[model samples]
Target chain A: MVRVTGVADETPTVRTIRFEDPGMAAALPGQFAMVWVPGGGELPMSVMAGDPGGAAFTVRRHGPASTALYGVDRGDLIGVRGPYGNTFDVREGRLLLAGGGTGMVPMMRLAMRVADPSRVVILMGARTAPEVIFERAAAALGEVVISTDDGSRGEEGTAVDAARRLLGSGRFSAAYVCGPEPMMAGIVAEARSRGVFVQASIERPMKCGVGICGSCCMGDRLVCSDGTVFDGDRLAATGEFGAIYRDKAGIARRY
Target chain B: MGLATRVAGIDLAGPAMLASGILGISMDVFRRLLDSGAGAVVSKSLSAEPREGYPNPTMAEAAGGWLNAVGLSNPGAPNFANMMRGAPGVPVVVSLVGSDPDEFVSMARLFEGLEVPAFELNLSCPHVEKVGLEVGDDPELVSRIVRSLKGAGVRVIAKVGLGSSDYLGTVRAAEDAGADAVTAINTVRAMSIDVHSGRPVLSNGFGGLSGPPIRPIAVRCVREITSRHEIPVIGCGGVSCWEDAAEFLLAGASAVQVGTAAGGNPGIFAEINSGISSYMERRGYSEISEVRRAA
Candidate 1:
């Protein structure tokens, strides 16, 4: 069980809930944990930055599960069951990280792991200025570029648009993206054309955050087991990557 | 010396199948499951057309089991058949779910030229409407659907679960309709509510309960089926360990399907198979049939 140490409202709908979890802090970036609220429900939450003293999760209010997760009081107990799925594999090359909305949660963790900030470029986007998350935190790690759909923040337009511009600069070896499927699909196409590898953390309805429930699958791959983090080639290979995904009912829904 | 077993004329490398709905979709995943030590792999229940199951909150933890309402999601039978065209020499049992006899027959017919070893008629999905338990509960519908599939010359295994009707009656209907075998106990109808929000935890509001909590009931169902009927029974429910597999076998299940257990580790198949092998050796049994025969 992890104790809530702090909760910071990152945006109107998103909040960063901090906890004291020594074990979770050791989990690699891009992995997630299954948090169980006593009466709410167990759901997968991406693990954010953590230290030996504390760990955190960036949760966006979406449903009862998230609401229950967000309703925690400081010091309330939450059951955690992972650090599941593959983590971002850092390599010896310039890195480009692109994220949008709550998708930026894992990206923030990735940004912190890079030893050389000069080799990193962070592209973030949201619907409006207030919705933008982890701007300062991301900026502290690397060069942060912000975009909002309403033109209320730096460079109006989708984050993929700014990512395309960054890719055109021709300085990165790979790109890591987490966001809406359509936006990630766009960024993946742009990155692939630029001869850069891309790793995307795709979200699916997860049951057993460990990989058994088969709830989190993209065609043949279980997002929880095979990955919530998929490489560009893997993303391209899965027919459902940007096209469709299975919901809680195991029915395919268009992205 | 060999862990191989046959159920309703379908050969399996082991007695454990990658249960329907978990990593049962792709040809690559099927191959991987087979390689990971599954005797056979059942596909996600395929419908006539693509279905976009319930919105988020599809699964939840309920004590010792999982409650899920993944509304029989699949890319339609025609699309899945195309995927099966690339089958990699593994024993693949295609699971088909539909509301009508024609829907089930048409879906089964699509695999006429494919390498599908058998078709498991999904007549027992508890949470979905129209299809699953709804269709399964109707004896006439179950019989007609099974008869039609049998007439198609497709080997059929009827998957049954506890619903409003007597689940055994559904099994009997399938057997009378010429179903080659029976898989006992799909997830039992169940639900969970978020006390804090005062709302159903699952977006679908209801789902099938699976995992360890359902294991004893599954074993009882398998035992009951074996006791009353002379058909091959595949036991499924909360089978997470080797002991559960052994218990199911002692209760008369010819084979068992692992679902929720695989959620935590796909490698559970390998582990279960390994554990079963060790048990058999220690007990001086060479064939799984020996345990079944003794039971």
Candidate 2:
């Protein structure tokens, strides 16, 4: 069982839950942990911090489990089952971490892990300025770029649009992206067109964080096992991840 | 407590088989399910050739379940045959789907001498525009598909999805077509809309709903099908616990397939298996069939 030590609202829609599990806190960036909220059911969440004792998850209160998570206070006991999936490869050079919505959480943690803070830049996009999460904390890690869809704050457009502007001004040695599927796909497509090395975190209905249940499958690949973090080329090659996936009936549909 | 059962001469130590289309298609994930204690693993639905499937977002969650519109994506039979070599100890049920009788016959013949334990004719996929539920809705197509697979020397289980009517007709058609058993029900036709966008949540605009939300409908399907046909019934959808499994058995299913619930907890299979065993012991019953219709 994991104990919740801290809880903070990163945005009106998203919240960050900090736990006191040293083992779970030590999870690598891009890897997710399953937080079992007792009767509410277990769901996979990405680790937003490198420290195990004070691990955090930035979750959007969209569904029942997520909504219930918002009500959780400090000292709540939640069952954690992971530190699962692969981690991002942090290399030295100009690194651009771009994400939208709650996808920015892991990117925030990735920024914190870089040895040289000056080499990293975080470009985040949200629906509005109020929706931008982890901005103050992210500013301490690197240059933070914000974009909103309605022009409420920052530049107005999709996150990929913001990433494009950042890429045009300078050469980025590596790129990491996470967000809604279309947004991630757009980032991957743009990164590929520019010959930039990229890795992305993909989301699905993850049931078993350990990869046995098959709910979070993208083709034959299990996101919980093979990756939430996949190389841009690998994602393109898999054909299943970004393009098509299997439905409940074993039918394949494009996404 | 013993959770073992037999299907077509194959002995399973447990009744909780991973239904087709979950994670059973991949050999790597299939191996993991066995390690996690699944009695058997059903491979993804395969056809004569490779299928590219439909577009995304193909799945969305509703109040009590999920809806998906995956259009039967597969690597084809010949490619899948290579992966079926030297599988784990449990029975390997290869699920096959096709557009017509000839395609079904050809696909079944491809598995000839491959030593698979069973052949599940997937006549129930709800997302395809044609050749799936359309054919399934017509008993003649189901009979034709099943008849084509006859003499393949493999146990045949016809899988059918739930519908407004014709549920009993489809089951009878599979029986008439020579299916040895039947599995019911696949996802129900459903849709979810993103309120923010004022559009359907799935890219396909609609999908098949599964999980706890569909349990009652699946149970009704099992009861109706099993009561009409002598063939064994494999109850699926929303079976997350022993009580749920027991409910399926009492409703007349010989076995049960755990899907979305298993997705949430793969260990639930073993847990359900053990729970069923304990319940059986407490009730002074021996075989799972003994509890069939207990309700």
Candidate 3:
């Protein structure tokens, strides 16, 4: 169990809670943890940032689990199960990093690991400026580009439009994407057509946060264990990447 | 010189069998486990048609264990068999879950000539309604499911767990029905409630519990089954370390199936195999049966 050391409200509905755990710093770029709030249900969340001092997870207040987690005060203890799943391969050269909503959480870590931070271009999109997360931090790491549906941010269109302008440059060797399915699909399609390698972080209804639960399966892959990160070719093969996914009831909820 | 052992007439490289629910989806996952030192792998429970299972929040954390009501999600027997066409050469056991004897018979027969070595009747899934504990609770149903599968030329093992009826009685029914082996204890029926939400944690009101918390109970079940009958017992539940595996062996389990422990680390199979082998060497036992016989 880790105790909450700090909590920062990034937005009206989103909060970044920092915790003290020795193992937190060891979490890889794409691995996730099952955060269990005592008396609150456990849920999977991607680690946004971590170091020896402590680790932080940014969550949008949504469900029962998130509500309980966001409500935790400093010094409250929460159970953590992982840092599970495969890590993002940032070994390649210049990369395109695109994220939307909380998907930007892991992208920040991936940005820092790249061989050249200057070579990384980040495209983040949200409904509006208040919803944009990690803009300053992401900008400090590399060139941060933003897109909001209401044109209250960097660009007038979606994150994919920014990705399209970046991809047109043809300088990037790979594209790392994590966002709402529609945005990811748009970026993935554009990147694939350009022949750039694309690694995507996917989301699914996960239970065990380990491979045991079939809740996170996409194609033959158990997303919880096999990946939260999949390459462009692999993601394309999964029939349900952006088309369909299961809800809390395990019923196929089509997007 | 050999780490190999035989359970229910099937040769295994080691005594670590991947439990029914974990990593049972694809041949690639199975081959990965085989490479990681699993002696054999069990497929997810298969019914007549594909089951989507329960909704999200299907799993939760308990004191030292996990509670899951995954609802036996699978791609039906025929679909899974088709998917396993490319299965690597390893001893794969198919766990079948169904409501009646006929369903068991047909599903077992569907996997014929698929290189599957045996069928494990999932008569003890505590979460599912008509297919699991409900079927296992009735000794007569257990007997009929076992008999029907056995008559299909597929060697069958009955997986028994705690239910409304006596678990030992269900084991007895399987034994009388000519089951090749018995896996003692599936997950125990359990639930977790979120005090703040005042609602059940899992989408399903209840789930089956597995992990370190259930180790003692499983050990007791293994000992009871081994003591009362002459059937081969595959011990399951909460085997995280080699010592736990040794405990099950001492309790008279011919082999042990690993579940919750492997969920955290798939590489645990190799560690457990080596740990068991080293212990066997220290004890001056050339074979696993020596320890079982001593017990």
Residue A210 accuracy (lDDT) in model 3:
77
Model 2 per-residue lDDT tens digits across residues B1-295: 4677885555555777888767655565666666677877788788787775554344445776666676676668876776565444434778888778888777777766675778887878887766567777878878777877775455788888865457789888888767888889888888876543356755566678888899998999888877777878889988888899999989998888887776646678788888888899999888887888576
Candidate 3: the clashing residue pairs are A248-B55, A248-B56, A249-B54, A249-B55, A249-B56, A250-B55
Encode model 2's per-residue lDDT on A1-255: one tens digit a residue: 677888887767778888877776687778887675644444678887656367887888887777766667898777666688888987668999998888887898788888567888888889888888888878988888899999998899989899888877667988899888888888888888888889999888754455544656764467887788988997886666567655433444667
Give model 2's DockQ, 2 decimals: 0.10
- What are the interface RMSDs of all the models? 4.4, 9.5, 4.6
Per-candidate Cα lDDT values, in order, are 0.83, 0.76, 0.84
List candidate 3 segments past 4 Å from native: A1-43, A47-95, A109-120, A125-141, A146-175, A180-199, A217-222, A226-255, B86-91, B195-198
What does the lDDT read for residue B267 in candidate 2?
79
DockQ score of candidate 3? 0.26
- Predictions' DockQ, in order: 0.32, 0.10, 0.26
State which candidate, 2 or 3, has the greater TM-score: 3
Better of 1 and 3 by lDDT: 3
Cα deviation at B213, candidate 1, in Å, is 1.3
Q: Against the true structure, candidate 1 has what lDDT?
A: 0.83
Q: State the lDDT of candidate 3 residue by residue for A152-180, as single tens digits.
A: 97798888888999999988899999988
- Model 3 chain A, TM-score vs. native: 0.96
lDDT value, residue B96 of candidate 3: 90
